[model samples]
Structures are given as C-alpha cells and as structure tokens.
Target: MLMVALCGAVAGFVLLGHSWLQLLIAGALGIIFTQFAFLAHEAAHRQIFAKGTTNDRYGRILGTAFVGISYSWWMNKHSRHHANPNRVGKDPDIEGEALAFYEEKAVPRTGLRAIIARKQGYLFFPMLILEGLNLHYASVKSLVTRSEKPTKGRFVEIGMLAGRFALYLGAVFWVLPVGMAFAFLGVQLAIFGLYMGASFAPNHKGMPIIPAEVKLDFFSRQVRTSRNIAGRFWPTVLMGGLNYQVEHHLFPSMARPHLARARLLVRQHCQDHDVPYTEVSLASSYGTVVSYLNRVGLAARDPFACPVASQLGRR
Candidate 1:
C-alpha cells in the first residue's frame, strides 16, 4: 500500500509541469486513489491486522491522507452494511439520496425528481461523475454534523482531510494555470467517482432488498444479498477482493488473498444447504443492476407496470 501511494505521488509530481495533457495523469491518480481506498476498506474491516487500533491507525492514514476520505465515517456506514446488507431502513447504501434503489423510494418522488426517478437506471452511471464530489461531501458532513460528541479521532481525521486537499490542490495549481488546474481536477474527480461506483455497485445494488421486518440467519442473509463477480486474479486485484463479496460479507476479516479458497468452501456449503448464491461476469452484473433499477423505477411511472400498484389492487 505504501509503495503504491509513493509511486502515485511521484508520477503525479513528474507530470505536473505538462500542459493540459496532465489531465491524463489526473485520471491515473484517480485510479490510484480508488486503489488506496480499497486497501483502506480492508484495513477498516480488520483484514490487514489483528489489533483494532493498529487497523484503525493505518485505515485512517490510507483513507484520509492518501484517498481524502473520512475513515471513521466510512467505518460507521460500512459496519451497518456488513451487519444488515440489503435490510430496508438499515443499509445506508440502499437509502438513495440522489437515485432511488427500490420501488417504494422511487414512488414518492414528484416534479423533476419524479421524471428523473423514472429514468434513474439509465442516468446512474453518468450521474456517477459527481459521486467523487458526493463522497467527499458526505465524509466531511458525517464528521462535522454526525459526530454528536466530538472525539480525538474526528479532529484527527478533519486535520488529515484538510492537509490532503491542501497538498493535492496546492501542487496542481502550482504547476498549471487556474483554468487548466480546475479542468484537471474535474477530470480526476469524474474518473475517481466512476471507477469507485463501478466496482462497489456490482456487489449488492441488484441483489434482493430484505424488508425491514424480515429476518434471516447470518449465512443466508449474507449469501442471498450479495453477488460475486466471476474471476480470480484480475477481479480480485481490480475490485480489491470485493469481487468475492459473498465471502467478504460472510467473513468480514478474511484477508484478500484467501477469498478464493473461502469462496469454494462457501459455495459448496450453500449448495448443500439449498441456499441461493449468485455469481456472474462483471458485465452481466452491471446489466442486472441497470435492469433492476429500471424495474424499480416503474413505480414512479405507469401504474400498470408498478409492483406496488399490483400489490395494492390484490389487497
């Protein structure tokens, strides 16, 4: 992780003197930031260390300083996700603030929001261009407003986030003209958001949304709600072990290297128990997510196509 961060920094520094072509470097750095975020995620899950404090120390540094994300905020949200993946009202990921992930959420929209809700599936990827900004905003918001009682961790993360932006933005402006620097940053943020969304969305966006009142055993809950992307080497490296999301959710602290073996074991166990397990190619997973979102969006459009309307008539 340290090596990757150092290499990214050196590469960015070397290319800063270039003209608008430096936007390429910005895009590459965005990828590097996503990679660092993956590592920070593992650290937050305790997959990198035995000691809790040790994991947090490295996670904070990697997430805040290198990736410019708030570790504490991510930890709080992600912990709930792991605990209750698709559970309604529990999983923060599905409580879409900008885009609706389920039918009921979409059905309540009005005006322009209603129009957007009806076509949200198609807009999802393009809208991800703003996700980088959204993530940064959410991180800062969580730290500043959500921290009911301020702690040392909050202060430390605030400082790290401030320092990260200062150094990163300072270097870009120092090397390029104002307009060029803004364009470079724009490219970087767009790529970062797109890549980050692509990798994480496939894990559970299309999976079953467990109603808040429903309950299931741990194994069933995790396996049923998670989708694994098919592949071993490249997928693991690309998604940072998130490709094996079933195993990761089942064994939150499992190291990235062991997810393959764990996947085999978990698959066999699920088969023996007659529990469903979903695994699909990366492209196919994206298709399913888009289709699922569009189907849910039906609730905001034609009543005949809306499942909620059907249910109401049945009642």
Candidate 2:
C-alpha cells in the first residue's frame, strides 16, 4: 500500500510538470487515487490494524492527504450508514439530499428534479460522474460547517485536505496548457468518481429497505439488506474486498484478506436461519438496481405501481 501510494505521488509529480503527459497521467492518477481510497476505507473500518486509533491514523492520512477527503467526516457519516443500513430516515445513503435513491426521498420534487426523478434509473451511472467532486466538497463542508462534536483530528484534517488540493490544482494549472489542464483534471476526477460508486452501489442498492419502525436482529438485518457479488479474482480485487458485503457489514473490521472465507460461513449461517441471501453477478446486480429504481420512478406518477401505496391500502 505504501509502495503504491509512493509510486503514484512520484509519478504524479513528474508527470504534472510535463504538458504532453498530463492526459495519460490524469487517467493513471485517478486509478491510483482510487486505490488509496480503498485502503483508506479499510482503515476507516479498522481492518488495517488491531487498534482503533491506529486505524484512524491510517484513515486520516490516506483519506485526507492522498484522496483529499476528510476522514473524520467520512467516519462519522459512514458509521451512521452502518448502524442503520437502509433505514428510511436514518441511513444517509438513501436520504437523497442530492439524488433520490428511494421512493420516499423523491417526493416534493419540482421542475428539473421531478424530471430527473422520473428517469433516475437511466441517470444513476451518469450521476456518479460527479460523485468524486461531491464527496470532496461534502467532506470539507462537514469539517467547517457540519460536524456535531468535531473529532480530535478534524482541524488537522481540514489542513491536509486543503493542502492536498492546493498542490494538485497548482501543479495542473501551472504545468499544463489551460485546455489540457482542464481535460486532465476532468478525466481524473470523472474516473475517480465512477470507479468509487460503481464498486460499491451493487452491494446494496437494490436490496430490501428496512422501514424505520421495523426491528431486526443484527445478522438477519445485514443479510437481508445487503447483496453480495458472486465471484473471485477480479471481483474480490476490484471491489477492494467489499463484494463480500454481507460479511463486511456483519464484521466490518475483519481484514480484507479474510472476507472470502467469512462469506462462506456467513452464507451458511443465513441458510441455517432461513434469512434471505441475495448474491448475483455484478451485471445482474446493476440490472436489479435499475429495475428497482424504475419501479419506484413509475410509482411516482402511477398510483397502481406504488408498492408502498398498495401496502398502505391493505392497512
């Protein structure tokens, strides 16, 4: 991990100064940044170390300094998402502050939002094009304006994030021609965004939503609400061990190396308890997500298609 980060930084510094290499470097840099992001994610979950603070150190350094995201902000938000996976009011993932991932979140929409809500399934992948920038913006905001009780390292994190971007922006603007710099920056951020979302959305996007009032046991809730991508090799490596979503949710701190084995045991446990275990190919999982979104989208305009409405009627 250190070696990868080092190589990325060294190569990025060298290439950023060369106008001719900016385009190629931008694409490679995006992948490198994403790899750091995956490692930072592991650190956030305490998977990289036995001690919590030690892991936080790794997370703060890797996520902020390298990925230009505030670790404290991410940790706080992600912790909530874990505690209440898809719980309607509690899970930030479906809160739809910017984009509506669920039916309830789409209500009260107007004009452009309403139009987009109707075609959200088609726009899901496209929207992820900006996720990288969105995450960075949110992370910085969380520190300056949004933190409840600011974590210990938040101020330092702010500095690191700002400094990281300063160097990145400075290099691109100073070293390359104006048009090429924009192209380089755009490509890097776009790939970073798409890679970030594509790798995680399939894990739980179309899974069962847990209503706010419903109570569930830990194991059952995690299994029922999460979907696992079934494969080895590329799936395991590409997803940064997150393709084992059920196991990761169940044991979020378990090392990435152990998730494959844990998945087998967790699957068997779910079977023993008759819990639903949804595992599908990566492509199929996306299909399920699109279908699910389209169903909810249609529900917005057609009462007959609203599953929630049908349930309310029975009551």
Candidate 3:
C-alpha cells in the first residue's frame, strides 16, 4: 500500500509533464515520503521484520536509498535515543552545538548566531528546508566516514542513494524548466521537513528533560519522559503509530500496528505503579512544544530565565 502510493506520487510527478500539476504531485510526494520515513523508522527498531538483519536490509532501501536518508546512521543514533531519551549530553536529538532545547544547554550566546538562536522556536519550521537536505548529507557521511572502519555496504548505499537522486532530479528537471524544478524541489523538501519535525517533536519536546546522570527504571523513564497524542486512524497513520510515543519508547521492538492496544495496557500499568502518563491532543501537544521552545528561548537572552528552575518551582 505504502510503496504503491509512493510510486504513484513519483510517477505523477514525472509523467504529469505540466509544471503546475508537477508541483501538486511534489506535495503528494513529500507526504508519501514522510510515511515512508515512518515505515523506515519502524524497520530500524525491528518492528517491521522479525529478524534485525532483514529489517536492516529493507530499511536501507526505504530510508537511505529511496527515501534519501541513511538507515544505519539513524539506527545508531535512534538506539541511543530510545535507551536514554531527553538525557542531556547523551540523546543526539537535543545536541546543544546550535540551538539548545534544554536549560542545561541554554547557557548564553553572542553574535549573530545568538540573535537567531533567541528566535529558534519561530525559526524552527523555516529551518527545516536545509534539515531535509542535511538528513541526506549526514546519512551518507555517516556511512562514508564511520571511524575509518566504514560501513559494510557503504558502496552499495552510495550507489543506491545516487541512483535515487539521479532518477528524482532527472525526472524533475527533464519535465519542467530549471526555475520550476527548483521551486518544486524547495516545496517538496520543506513539506517533508515540516512533516517529519511536526510528527516527532511533540512526543518529547515539551516533556521533562532528564539529566545525564539520572538512572531510572525502563518503564518509569519511558512513561515519565514521553508524551502521547490522543487520536485514532489519521493521527496513527500520520505519526506512523507514534501517537503512542511512550509505548513506542518502552517497547522499541514492538510493531506499529500493535502500539495502540499496547498503549492502553501501558497506561493502566503506569497508573498501577503511580507513574505519570502524559497524553494530550495533537494540537495541545504541538502548542506545548512551541511554548516550551519559546520559553527556553528566553534563557538565551536573559541568563536568569531557566525553564528547569521554573519546572522545579511549579513542582
């Protein structure tokens, strides 16, 4: 079903011939690609295929080759994230080199970067244009230069990705003028970026930021730190069953189809154990994420503004 939709979208983009219709097809392609991304993510966690190796093999194509992302790189980083989400200095998601998501990383900045960092919450959506591109670049780079040891199928990965891009760009540029092609590419990538970010960020963005040294049990850690979005089919499809973020985090190997049922049991278990289970509407979760980012962004300008301290105060 997913593969067919993707092929149709891509085919329409190439065969439509007309520039305006091609642009519409590009939008469909972006949404379809994001769904492919979710499937690839599930594959990385061994949810799609029973065997890790099988999932990895297929995931490489869905992610690195067809989807233009590196599955190996995502797996390595995502494994760490699953093990210790929101942990400062550990979870790769919140790397502080550029914009800080947590109070610990929001020390202070100077110069133009600081000015931009101050408004990162607002800039986050717009910055995703390069983010989609960066995903491809990082994936290839990780495979190409992994501690000089190099990945096993590095050449194959490179060839597949090159072919995918060649076909994609070849179709676009061939079917349309150079300027329209660029515009089409821009819209497609931007939507992909926004779709990707919008899906994942709300899962943990506004939730508690665990300290690097904190050691909690698996169930507690996962449930406490992750937020679930309340919805059924559309949200599940869009989030790739990740609306049950807490459940997904707790059971990394579980299949996406089973996540919804599992969440009910997980929620009951958490209540039995007196653990806080954070769940909210999709809109609510996103609002919290935006509020959290803007709140943390305040710390960039005023050293006294600390979200961590504020959380403690509320507690």
Task: Give per-model TM-scores.
Answer: 0.93, 0.91, 0.91
Clash counts for the predictions, in order: 0, 0, 0
Sort by TM-score, best first: what order?
Answer: 1, 3, 2
What tens digits encode model 2's per-residue C-alpha lDDT throughout 184-237? 888889988989999989977878888899998887778888999999879988
Clashing pairs in 3: none
Q: Write the per-residue lDDT of candidate 1 for residues 148-236, one digit (tens) a residue.
A: 55644998999999999999899888888899889999999999999999999999998999999999999889999999999999999
Off by over 4 Å in 2: 5-21, 146-148, 302-315
Candidates in descending lDDT order: 1, 2, 3
Better of 1 and 2 by lDDT: 1
Best by TM-score: 1
Error of 1 at 225 (Å): 0.4
Over 4 Å off, model 1: 1-9, 15-18, 149-152, 302-315
Weakest ten-residue segment in model 3 by summed lDDT: 298-307
Candidate 3 lDDT, 227-299, residue by residue in tens: 9999878899888988989988888889878888998898898889788999999989878877787777666
Better of 1 and 3 by lDDT: 1
How accurate locally, in lDDT, is each candidate? 0.89, 0.83, 0.81
Output the TM-score of candidate 1.
0.93
